[model samples]
Target: MDVLQIVAIGLMATVLIGVLKSQRPELAVLLSVAVGVILFLLVLGKIGSIVDIITDLATRAGISMVYLGTIMKIIGIAYIAEFGAQICRDAGEGAVATKIEFAAKILIMVLAVPIVVAVLQSLLKLLG
Candidate 1:
Protein backbone atom coordinates (compact mmCIF):
# COMPACT_ATOMS: atom_id res chain seq x y z
CA MET A 1 0.00 0.00 0.00
CA ASP A 2 2.10 2.86 1.27
CA VAL A 3 5.52 1.77 0.12
CA LEU A 4 6.96 5.19 0.77
CA GLN A 5 5.88 5.12 4.39
CA ILE A 6 7.49 1.72 4.86
CA VAL A 7 10.67 2.87 3.17
CA ALA A 8 10.71 5.99 5.28
CA ILE A 9 10.34 3.93 8.41
CA GLY A 10 13.18 1.68 7.30
CA LEU A 11 15.40 4.64 6.64
CA MET A 12 14.47 6.14 9.99
CA ALA A 13 15.35 2.88 11.71
CA THR A 14 18.69 2.76 9.92
CA VAL A 15 19.41 6.28 11.02
CA LEU A 16 18.42 5.48 14.55
CA ILE A 17 20.83 2.55 14.52
CA GLY A 18 23.63 4.79 13.42
CA VAL A 19 22.85 7.37 16.07
CA LEU A 20 22.36 4.84 18.81
CA LYS A 21 25.60 3.08 18.01
CA SER A 22 27.62 6.17 18.85
CA GLN A 23 25.72 7.30 21.97
CA ARG A 24 24.37 4.19 23.73
CA PRO A 25 25.12 1.01 21.83
CA GLU A 26 23.31 -1.22 24.29
CA LEU A 27 20.16 0.85 24.15
CA ALA A 28 20.54 1.13 20.40
CA VAL A 29 19.88 -2.59 19.97
CA LEU A 30 16.77 -2.36 22.08
CA LEU A 31 15.62 0.73 20.23
CA SER A 32 16.13 -0.97 16.88
CA VAL A 33 14.15 -3.98 18.09
CA ALA A 34 11.42 -1.71 19.37
CA VAL A 35 11.21 0.09 16.07
CA GLY A 36 10.92 -3.21 14.22
CA VAL A 37 8.25 -4.36 16.62
CA ILE A 38 6.27 -1.15 16.12
CA LEU A 39 6.40 -1.61 12.38
CA PHE A 40 5.33 -5.22 12.77
CA LEU A 41 2.36 -4.13 14.86
CA LEU A 42 1.27 -1.71 12.18
CA VAL A 43 1.37 -4.46 9.56
CA LEU A 44 -0.46 -6.88 11.84
CA GLY A 45 -3.22 -4.32 12.36
CA LYS A 46 -3.86 -4.31 8.62
CA ILE A 47 -3.91 -8.09 8.57
CA GLY A 48 -6.43 -8.11 11.40
CA SER A 49 -8.77 -5.90 9.40
CA ILE A 50 -8.52 -8.33 6.49
CA VAL A 51 -9.35 -11.27 8.76
CA ASP A 52 -12.35 -9.38 10.14
CA ILE A 53 -13.60 -8.87 6.59
CA ILE A 54 -13.20 -12.56 5.86
CA THR A 55 -15.11 -13.48 9.01
CA ASP A 56 -17.90 -11.10 8.07
CA LEU A 57 -18.15 -12.56 4.59
CA ALA A 58 -18.19 -16.08 5.99
CA THR A 59 -21.01 -15.11 8.30
CA ARG A 60 -23.03 -13.64 5.46
CA ALA A 61 -22.48 -16.81 3.40
CA GLY A 62 -24.08 -18.90 6.15
CA ILE A 63 -20.92 -20.79 6.90
CA SER A 64 -20.55 -22.46 10.28
CA MET A 65 -19.26 -19.98 12.81
CA VAL A 66 -17.25 -22.75 14.44
CA TYR A 67 -15.35 -23.32 11.22
CA LEU A 68 -14.81 -19.60 10.66
CA GLY A 69 -13.60 -19.24 14.20
CA THR A 70 -11.31 -22.21 13.76
CA ILE A 71 -9.80 -20.65 10.65
CA MET A 72 -9.22 -17.39 12.51
CA LYS A 73 -7.66 -19.30 15.37
CA ILE A 74 -5.34 -21.01 12.95
CA ILE A 75 -4.34 -17.64 11.56
CA GLY A 76 -3.70 -16.41 15.08
CA ILE A 77 -1.55 -19.44 15.79
CA ALA A 78 0.50 -18.91 12.67
CA TYR A 79 1.06 -15.24 13.44
CA ILE A 80 1.93 -15.85 17.08
CA ALA A 81 4.23 -18.73 16.20
CA GLU A 82 6.03 -16.65 13.63
CA PHE A 83 6.34 -13.81 16.12
CA GLY A 84 7.66 -16.04 18.89
CA ALA A 85 9.99 -17.89 16.55
CA GLN A 86 11.36 -14.63 15.18
CA ILE A 87 12.01 -13.31 18.66
CA CYS A 88 13.66 -16.58 19.66
CA ARG A 89 15.85 -16.52 16.59
CA ASP A 90 16.73 -12.90 17.25
CA ALA A 91 17.78 -13.92 20.73
CA GLY A 92 19.91 -16.71 19.28
CA GLU A 93 17.67 -19.53 20.38
CA GLY A 94 17.13 -21.62 17.28
CA ALA A 95 16.04 -24.61 19.34
CA VAL A 96 13.33 -22.59 21.02
CA ALA A 97 12.15 -21.31 17.66
CA THR A 98 11.84 -24.84 16.38
CA LYS A 99 9.81 -25.82 19.43
CA ILE A 100 7.46 -22.91 18.91
CA GLU A 101 6.89 -23.90 15.29
CA PHE A 102 6.31 -27.54 16.26
CA ALA A 103 3.80 -26.57 18.91
CA ALA A 104 1.95 -24.29 16.51
CA LYS A 105 1.63 -26.99 13.87
CA ILE A 106 0.41 -29.56 16.40
CA LEU A 107 -2.16 -27.17 17.82
CA ILE A 108 -3.38 -26.26 14.34
CA MET A 109 -3.87 -29.94 13.53
CA VAL A 110 -5.74 -30.48 16.76
CA LEU A 111 -8.03 -27.54 16.04
CA ALA A 112 -8.68 -28.83 12.52
CA VAL A 113 -9.93 -32.22 13.64
CA PRO A 114 -13.53 -31.05 14.02
CA ILE A 115 -13.62 -29.66 10.50
CA VAL A 116 -12.16 -32.87 9.20
CA VAL A 117 -14.83 -34.87 11.03
CA ALA A 118 -17.57 -32.69 9.60
CA VAL A 119 -16.26 -33.24 6.10
CA LEU A 120 -16.11 -36.99 6.60
CA GLN A 121 -19.67 -37.02 7.84
CA SER A 122 -20.85 -35.12 4.78
CA LEU A 123 -19.00 -37.55 2.53
CA LEU A 124 -20.55 -40.56 4.25
CA LYS A 125 -24.01 -39.08 3.90
CA LEU A 126 -23.44 -38.52 0.19
CA LEU A 127 -22.27 -42.10 -0.21
CA GLY A 128 -25.34 -43.43 1.59
Candidate 2:
Protein backbone atom coordinates (compact mmCIF):
# COMPACT_ATOMS: atom_id res chain seq x y z
CA MET A 1 0.00 0.00 0.00
CA ASP A 2 1.08 3.54 -0.57
CA VAL A 3 0.65 4.28 3.13
CA LEU A 4 2.99 1.41 3.94
CA GLN A 5 5.82 3.41 2.48
CA ILE A 6 5.24 6.23 4.92
CA VAL A 7 5.01 3.78 7.79
CA ALA A 8 8.25 2.10 6.75
CA ILE A 9 10.14 5.34 6.61
CA GLY A 10 8.71 6.40 9.94
CA LEU A 11 9.66 3.10 11.57
CA MET A 12 13.18 3.26 10.24
CA ALA A 13 13.61 6.77 11.47
CA THR A 14 12.23 5.84 14.87
CA VAL A 15 14.76 3.09 15.21
CA LEU A 16 17.61 5.33 14.18
CA ILE A 17 16.49 8.01 16.62
CA GLY A 18 16.38 5.46 19.42
CA VAL A 19 19.86 4.16 18.65
CA LEU A 20 21.37 7.63 18.42
CA LYS A 21 19.48 9.15 21.33
CA SER A 22 21.98 7.88 23.92
CA GLN A 23 25.17 8.43 21.92
CA ARG A 24 24.35 11.61 20.02
CA PRO A 25 21.29 13.42 21.21
CA GLU A 26 21.77 16.37 18.86
CA LEU A 27 22.06 14.18 15.78
CA ALA A 28 18.89 12.38 16.77
CA VAL A 29 17.01 15.66 16.74
CA LEU A 30 18.46 16.54 13.36
CA LEU A 31 17.58 13.15 11.98
CA SER A 32 14.00 13.51 13.20
CA VAL A 33 13.59 16.86 11.45
CA ALA A 34 15.21 15.61 8.26
CA VAL A 35 12.93 12.59 8.20
CA GLY A 36 9.89 14.76 8.75
CA VAL A 37 10.87 16.96 5.81
CA ILE A 38 11.52 13.96 3.61
CA LEU A 39 8.08 12.57 4.41
CA PHE A 40 6.45 15.90 3.61
CA LEU A 41 8.30 16.12 0.32
CA LEU A 42 7.22 12.63 -0.66
CA VAL A 43 3.59 13.78 -0.53
CA LEU A 44 4.26 17.23 -1.97
CA GLY A 45 3.19 16.16 -5.43
CA LYS A 46 -0.28 15.27 -4.13
CA ILE A 47 -0.51 18.67 -2.50
CA GLY A 48 0.19 20.33 -5.86
CA SER A 49 -2.55 18.32 -7.48
CA ILE A 50 -5.04 19.32 -4.79
CA VAL A 51 -4.12 22.98 -5.29
CA ASP A 52 -4.70 22.70 -9.04
CA ILE A 53 -8.12 21.16 -8.52
CA ILE A 54 -9.14 23.80 -6.01
CA THR A 55 -7.97 26.58 -8.31
CA ASP A 56 -9.96 25.19 -11.21
CA LEU A 57 -13.11 24.88 -9.14
CA ALA A 58 -12.73 28.36 -7.70
CA THR A 59 -12.35 29.80 -11.19
CA ARG A 60 -15.46 28.02 -12.41
CA ALA A 61 -17.47 29.24 -9.40
CA GLY A 62 -16.51 32.90 -9.94
CA ILE A 63 -14.52 33.01 -6.71
CA SER A 64 -11.81 35.65 -6.61
CA MET A 65 -8.28 34.38 -6.86
CA VAL A 66 -7.27 36.77 -4.11
CA TYR A 67 -9.34 34.82 -1.61
CA LEU A 68 -7.89 31.57 -2.89
CA GLY A 69 -4.38 32.91 -2.51
CA THR A 70 -5.08 33.97 1.04
CA ILE A 71 -6.51 30.57 1.86
CA MET A 72 -3.45 28.89 0.40
CA LYS A 73 -1.16 31.00 2.51
CA ILE A 74 -3.16 30.14 5.61
CA ILE A 75 -2.82 26.45 4.84
CA GLY A 76 0.89 26.77 4.26
CA ILE A 77 1.31 28.54 7.53
CA ALA A 78 -0.60 25.80 9.34
CA TYR A 79 1.46 22.97 7.86
CA ILE A 80 4.75 24.72 8.47
CA ALA A 81 3.75 25.55 12.01
CA GLU A 82 2.86 21.97 12.74
CA PHE A 83 6.13 20.79 11.27
CA GLY A 84 8.08 23.19 13.44
CA ALA A 85 6.13 22.28 16.54
CA GLN A 86 6.73 18.59 15.97
CA ILE A 87 10.46 19.16 15.59
CA CYS A 88 10.53 21.13 18.80
CA ARG A 89 8.62 18.46 20.64
CA ASP A 90 10.94 15.77 19.34
CA ALA A 91 13.83 17.76 20.75
CA GLY A 92 12.17 17.59 24.19
CA GLU A 93 11.02 21.19 24.20
CA GLY A 94 7.27 21.09 24.77
CA ALA A 95 7.16 24.72 25.78
CA VAL A 96 8.72 25.84 22.52
CA ALA A 97 6.31 23.67 20.54
CA THR A 98 3.34 25.25 22.31
CA LYS A 99 4.67 28.70 21.56
CA ILE A 100 5.15 27.86 17.92
CA GLU A 101 1.56 26.61 17.70
CA PHE A 102 0.23 29.70 19.43
CA ALA A 103 2.07 31.96 17.02
CA ALA A 104 0.78 30.05 14.02
CA LYS A 105 -2.80 30.28 15.21
CA ILE A 106 -2.44 34.02 15.65
CA LEU A 107 -1.01 34.38 12.19
CA ILE A 108 -3.82 32.31 10.75
CA MET A 109 -6.38 34.51 12.41
CA VAL A 110 -4.74 37.62 11.01
CA LEU A 111 -4.69 36.21 7.52
CA ALA A 112 -8.35 35.22 7.78
CA VAL A 113 -9.55 38.77 8.40
CA PRO A 114 -9.86 39.65 4.74
CA ILE A 115 -11.95 36.62 3.95
CA VAL A 116 -14.12 37.23 6.98
CA VAL A 117 -14.74 40.78 5.80
CA ALA A 118 -15.63 39.62 2.34
CA VAL A 119 -18.10 37.12 3.74
CA LEU A 120 -19.70 39.69 5.99
CA GLN A 121 -20.13 42.05 3.05
CA SER A 122 -21.85 39.34 1.06
CA LEU A 123 -24.20 38.56 3.92
CA LEU A 124 -25.04 42.24 4.43
CA LYS A 125 -25.75 42.66 0.77
CA LEU A 126 -28.08 39.69 0.82
CA LEU A 127 -30.02 41.08 3.80
CA GLY A 128 -30.36 44.54 2.29
Please state every model's RMSD to the true fold in angstroms: 3.4, 1.7
Clashes (backbone N, CA, C under 3 Å), per candidate, total 0, 0
The C-alpha stretches of model 1 lying farther than 4 A from their native spots are: 1-3, 14-33, 43-48
Q: Show the colliding residue pairs in model 1.
A: none
Q: Candidate 2's residue-wise lDDT over 1-128, tens digit each? A: 75899999999999999999999999999999889888988898888889999999999999999999999999999999999998899889999999999999999999999999989999999999
lDDT of each: 0.85, 0.94
Which parts of model 2 are misplaced by more than 4 Å? Answer: 1-4
Residue 31 in model 1: shift from native, Å?
4.4
lDDT of 2: 0.94
Q: Given candidate 2, what's the lDDT at residue 67?
A: 93
Worst 10 residues of 1 by lDDT: 84-93
